[model samples]
Target: MDIKQLKFLIALDETRHFGQAATRCHITQPTLSMRLRNLEEELGLPLVRRGQRFEGFTAEGERILAWARSLMAAHDGLYAEASACRGQLVGTLRLGLVPLGGFEPMRLLSLFRRQHPNLRFQLFALSSEQILEGLTRNQLDLGLSYLDRLAREQFDSLELADTRMGLLYDQRHFSFTQTSLNWEQLGSLPLGLLSSGMHFRQSIDHAFRSRGLIAQPLLESDSVHNLLQAVSAGLCCAVMPLNGGLEVGNPHLRLLPIAEAHTLAPLGLILRRSAPRSALAEACFEEARRALADELRLSADR
Candidate 1:
């Protein structure tokens, strides 16, 4: 019935354990249970399914939990808006970033921090699917991911950069003395690639399939550093995005753009579209626009 009760419910849902949820809410387990019971009594519906331990929520509870998240989001947005009027934006901005190991997300966050010092940030390195899921669930305020996968009607976006796929390898390992490399050329090399479930990896697979080739990766990992390390050690070549957190000065490694890599898309920021947008989300979006404007302009000039 009250915000505290809703908070307790959400906490329980997140932790999936009564004791842990109580600890998160800074309340005793008994008190938390009493409040939730009172809430159930007021609503005349059973929210939680009872057992020896926390089993799960009822169907009704799932619906109510969604509303609870929306209510909390709106409440936080209102508070942020009020604080901004007083010349300081204060609140935690949760950001979901694709685990691309790129500098673009960090650069944007750094610029945002300088502009709004009072604001706090919680960053999560997630997959594109996870980022989208978090945004939909109201668990993330913003996400930095590939713009092509996001539904335009479901979310608003800002393109940060035009991403390009490339080949990463040690110059000493192979005889690939070319300005660019294509998927067909990469078919014979022992390669390191991201896990198959990842969007980045899926893109790589698609590119290879289009050329009637299949990549036989010697190493498969979710970590970009692992792939880079493999290339650095001359263990295998890698195919990855050129702008996805690649370090250009590595003496052992070289990144060459993939020839005719038209499938790679723009990487950018996304916010879930909702009525009465979060003040923090809007501020961050506008700030990103301003921060990237100069760079975009210079690129245009060149």
Candidate 2:
């Protein structure tokens, strides 16, 4: 069948409503209905069960929808490859990043644009759940997130950095001179924590539980930067990833490593398993790999 007809079927399957599907496909309801009717006529079977409302697709329609998604993905891949061959890498590269992953996409973007100046990049700061959903829908080209609790089969992962948990406190308030402190010591102090939705926060909570302690945060925030700001203001201390974007110049802030024997978390790049790489994607990937290697070597030297 025609590619447009296949697209219509896929949209219908996703939305399960004629008007909503037509809107998604950027067509009028009548046009979508006509296309579906013509497709069914060509196949000599009713593709959808009609009733008072848009009920559901027939068995053949369900099968067609599956094949349609695969076909559309392949078609898009071919277009991307052809565009790359023309020396014009011109398409939107969508990326989702966790807020605290220490990924400097700005650096990657600068490098990518120098090579593929025509490419467009769309970056979203999203939760892990949204990143996975965007990848499944073929909306995102790459994701940067924590590796904990990730579903391995759905995406290919490349470890980019080791993120260590640490206590961020105002040195003046605590009079702590050492570089790190034990978990038990932290438990004795009032603290601020990340809100429950963030994966980093959950990891911190898990670390506390493993030590037979409870995390009772006097203040909680969804924003990592805000949490750091609070600590700088001496509102309370917070446990955060060492690689979180706080700089050393933030006079009131000090990063103290968590004393739990091992507290490093893996931060990485994730891409759909079936996604074909574009010139821009490959360039960004290579830069990330190089940066990760440098980080590892620095840690070894230390």
Candidate 3:
């Protein structure tokens, strides 16, 4: 019925326990219960099923919760836009990113802060699946992930960069006499790969399958940093993206590009189709586009 009621409903849905939900909302349990009861009375439909413990919501309650989330999201967006209209870009911008995408939030944050010094930015490193879920739940304003994996109807995206996959190894463990490796050459090595849930790993799997080859990684990780560490320790060679490649600048590590035509993946920025964009979001988007373009041009020149 009201913003407060909607907030309570969303909190309850997320926590699934009245006590935990009340704690999240910074309210007492009795107050939360009374509010939900009042809401149900007004709607003439029982929302949450009664139980000694936390039970799931009823059918009508589920529908109400869904609408509540959208309403709250729009209301929050309106507040952010109104604040931006006063010549100040001041609001929290929540972003979800795949760990291997090589997005350095600090660099972008530095530039963004110079333009809108009052803006707040929250960054979350998430797997591709988590990023997609966050976008659908209205928990993340934007996501950095593989463009090919996103559903076109539910979201919109802009291609940011081509993430080139390569093999990284400790020179102490293996010598890179060749400039690049074909899929067959890579298949011969004990490699570390991203977890199967990540788009990067999926891309690698597809490349192998298309060539009638099997990729059996010796190690698997969700974090790019961990994979780099493994390569530095001479555990195994790794298949990783160019952005992540920049982090493994150790003298011990050698990076060799994958020469197969299908190894490249495009990294992109995704956002909900109906979510409102704040001035800060617009500035961040423009900066990413510009940075990606510059990087592409430099790569072409080289």
Best by lDDT: 1
Tens digit of lDDT per residue, candidate 2, span 1-302?
A: 78999889878876889999999999999999999999999988888988876899889877766666767766766777788787667666778887666555566677667767877888988888888876776656788877775778877778866667677788767668677788788888879987887777777788789889998998998787787778877789888767665646777677777776233357788777655444455556676677668878998999
- Candidate 2 lDDT for residue 240: 70
Candidate 1 lDDT, 1-302, residue by residue in tens:
78999999999998999999999999999999999999999999999997989999999999988888889989998999999999888999999887553336778878889999988899887888899988998988999887778899999998876666778878888666789987788887899989988767877888888888887899999887788888888899888777765756677677788887633566789999976468898899889888788888998999
Every candidate's lDDT: 0.84, 0.76, 0.79
User: What is the alpha-carbon lDDT for the whole of candidate 1?
Assistant: 0.84
- Candidate 2: list runs displaced more than 4 Å: 1-79, 102-107, 110-114, 171-174, 261-265, 275-279, 290-302
Instruction: Tell me the lDDT of model 2 at 207.
Output: 79
Give per-residue CA lDDT, model 3, range 150-227, as digits (tens): 799988787766777777788888897888898998888989998886777888898998899998999998877788
User: In candidate 3, which residue ranges exceed 4 Å CA deviation?
Assistant: 14-23, 27-38, 46-56, 102-107, 126-133, 149-155, 171-175, 223-233, 245-254, 261-265, 275-280, 286-302
lDDT of 3: 0.79
Q: Kindly report which residue stretches of model 1 are placed more than 4 angstroms away from their true locations once superposed.
A: 28-31, 50-52, 101-103, 169-179, 223-236, 246-256
lDDT of 1 at 119: 82
